[model samples]
Target: MAGPNSDPIVSATTAAQLPPGAVVLHVEAGDRQSAEAAFAAGHVEGAVLLVRDEVVTRPMRPGDGRHPLPSAEDLADALGRLGVGWDAPVVAYDRQHGDNAAHVVHLLRLLGQDARLLDGGLAAFTDPVATGPGTTPTAVAREPRPWPADMLPDIDAVAAHAAAGGVLIDARAAERFRGETEPLDPIAGHIPGAVNAFYGDNLTPDGTFRDPEELRARFAALGAGPDAVVYCGSGVTACHDLLAIERAGLGRARLYVGSWSQWCRDASRPRATGPA
Candidate 1:
C-alpha cells in the first residue's frame, strides 16, 4: 500500500492489517463512546480510535461551510497522537454515515498525507475481524506533515481554480447537482462547468469502493489527476472523490473546502443549471 501501483485501499475480504509499519487510523463520525468500546473490544487488527470532534475535525465557524473543515494544524496534532505522518497508510471510516469517511480523507490529503478510507468501513472490519485483543502495527516513517494551509478556500479561490482548468467534482446527489432541489446550500444550482459524480458512485453495492480500473476510467474522463482539484457542498463529501482517486491508484487530488456553500454565497461566481 506504499507504492503508486498498490491495489485497492479497502477490500471485502481483508480488514486491512496495518501492514508492519503502517498507520491505520479508524475514525468514526458522531459519538465517541462507541468507538472507544469497539477499540477496547477489538479493531482491524491494528487500528487507532479517532473521534470526529476531538481529533478528526475542528468546530465549524459561522462564515465557514455547514460542515466543519478541520484545520491542517489540528489534524497534524491528531496524526501525531496516532503515530502518523506524510507517508503513513491511513484508513478512515464512519459506521453511521456511508460518506463520513470522505470528510476525514479530504482533511488528511489537504495536509498532504497519504490517507484512504475503508470501503465497507465498520461493517467490513467487523466481518473480517474479531474483537478480543490486537497488536499495534510497526512504525515506518515519521516525516512531519506538509506545510499547512492558512485557511480553507472560500468561493473566490474556488472560482479562480475552476477557471484555471480544475475539475469541480460535485459530490451531491444527482438531483441537487442538476438543480432539482437543494436542502443544504442557499442556491440550488452547481458551480459552472462542474461535473456531477455523486460521492456514492465511488462505492460498490456492498459499501466497499468500486474496482480501481473503473474509478480510473471515470476520473480520467474528468481530467482529475495528481494536480487536479475537487469540491462539493461544504467540502465534506468531496473527499469521497479524493479517496476514490487515491484508491484507484490514479493520483492525489486537492479539495475545495468551501464548495457550493461558499460559491453560492458569492453571487459573482458563475452557476450552472442543466446536468453534465
Candidate 2:
C-alpha cells in the first residue's frame, strides 16, 4: 500500500529532480480541447495531457455524481494508450494547485501504482517549457483490475459511518457547508454530522501543500483519523484532503465517490446546514 513514506508528493526545482523514467502527466480538469490548447501553449517537457473527461471519468448519470469513476477496463485502456504501464511511476500536475492532479494520483494509488502529485503545480516548476503537441510514447499493454473495494465506500456505507459516529468530512467551502451558497449541486447543505474541511485549506498561500505535521494537526482538530470518510460536491476535489491526510502520515481514508451530488439527489438521506 502506498503511504506518506512512499514519497506521494514531489517538488522539482528542475526537471532533473523529477523521478527518472516516471511518466509525467499534465492532468486537466476540463475537456480535451481545453487541455490540448493549454498543453500546446506550453508545458513541462515530456509531459502528456491527461484530460479528466477523456481518461479518468465517465459521463455523469442520475445516481453517480457529475464526475463518475470510469470502469476498470476503460481506465486501463486509457492509461495504456498513454504508455502508462501498471508498474510505471507517475507524476501528475495541473496549471494551478493539484486538485485535479491529486484526483488522478488518488485513483492511480488505489490501483496499487506508484503515483505522486507535483507540489505547487506548474507555477512552481522551474524547468524550461516545451510547446506544440508534446511527445507521445508508444502505447503499452495494460490489464484491467477491479477497483479496490476497501478504499471506496458507497452512500450507505457513508451513512453507516456517520450513524456509528465515525468521522465524516465534507471537503467543500464553508459557505456551501453552511447552506449559504451552492454553485454546483442543487443542495446547499452537507451530509448530516459531517465536519467542514475545505480542501483549499490543505495548501499554503503559494499553493503548495502544508507540511505533513501541520496537516496532521488540522485534521486532528476536526476529529478525523485513518477511518475517516471524505466527500465533496462531486467527489473530485475531495482527493485533495485524502492526499493531505496521507501526507500527514495518517492512514489512507475511505472516499465516498457519490458525494453531495448523489446524496442530495435523494431527499430521504438527512442533510444539515450551518457550521459543523
Candidate 3:
C-alpha cells in the first residue's frame, strides 16, 4: 500500500505556516451548529468552510450526476476566492467527524490541489465537544489563480472503467448501499456489480482514519486493491473511504462523481438491494 499523492491528514498550526510553495488547505465541514462553533472559536488561519450548495459547480442537478465533478474553472474560482492556489497545502476539518470534509477532499484533489484533511477535523483540534462562538478568523484567503486538477472521474468515465473490468466499490454506509434509504437521492440501491465498503469502517475510535496496514487488510478482504473506484451516496463520504485506503497506502482510487445520487437518477442503470 502506498499513500495518496499527498498525506491523508495534516495539522492546522504547522500546515498554515508551511513554506509558500507548499499548498495546505484548512477546510471546515459540518452542519450549521458545528460550523458556527468552529467559526466562533476560530478555525485554522486561512481556512474555508465549504457550504455544500456553494461548493459544487451546478448546485442541484439530480441524477444528472450524483456529485457532479465541478469544472476546473469553477473549482479553481472557488479555491482562488478562498486564497487557495494549486501550490498551497490544503488542510481540511469539520466540527464533528469530518463528514463534509470527505467530499471537500475529493473535490479538491479532483481540481488538482495538493489537499489533505486535518486529523480529527476541528474536533481533533481541542477535541472540542463544545465551542463558544468563535470570532471570525483573521486569516482571509487571498485569491490565487486556479490550478488545474484531474482527480475526479465523470459518470461516463466510470461507466467506461466498469465496462473495462475495473473494480467499482460502493463506499456508502451499509444500509444506504442496501437501498434501505433514499435521503439525498431520487433512487435507492447501488450500481450493479459494485462492492460494499462502508466509509465509516475506515475510522478508528478517535474518528481519525485507521492505520495503513489495517486498511489494507480490510480492503483486501473485499477483493479491492489500489486500483479500485469508490463511490458513495453523492460522491461525498466515499472520498473518506478513498482517503483511508490511500492513507493506509492501498493505492490510488478513482471517484465516480455521480455515485448513488447519479446512479439512482437513471432508471436504465442496474441497481442492487439487500446485503452486499
Q: For each candidate in the order shown, give its overall lDDT on alpha carbons.
A: 0.67, 0.88, 0.64
Query: Can you rank all candidates by lDDT, best first?
Result: 2, 1, 3
Error of 1 at 171 (Å): 1.6
The C-alpha TM-scores of every prediction are 0.76, 0.97, 0.79
Poorest 10 consecutive residues of model 1 by lDDT?
1-10
Model 1: colliding residue pairs = none
The residue-by-residue lDDT of candidate 3 on 1-276, one tens digit each, is 113545566644354244354433334443556555556575554445455545554555644664465655665566666556555666666656666776786566655567677667655654223334433323334443343223456677777777787788988778888888878777788777788988877778877777778887988777665567888887777878877776766666777766777767776666789876
Score residue 221 of candidate 1 by CA lDDT.
89
Give the TM-score comparing model 3 with the true structure, all chains together. Answer: 0.79
Q: Top model by TM-score, which number?
A: 2
lDDT of 1 at 231: 77
In the range 207-236, model 2's lDDT, one tens digit per residue, is 999999899899988877668999999888
Clash tally, candidates in order: 0, 0, 19
Query: Which segments of candidate 2 are over 4 A away from where they belong?
Result: none
Alpha-carbon runs more than 4 Å astray in model 3: 1-6, 11-38, 127-151, 163-165
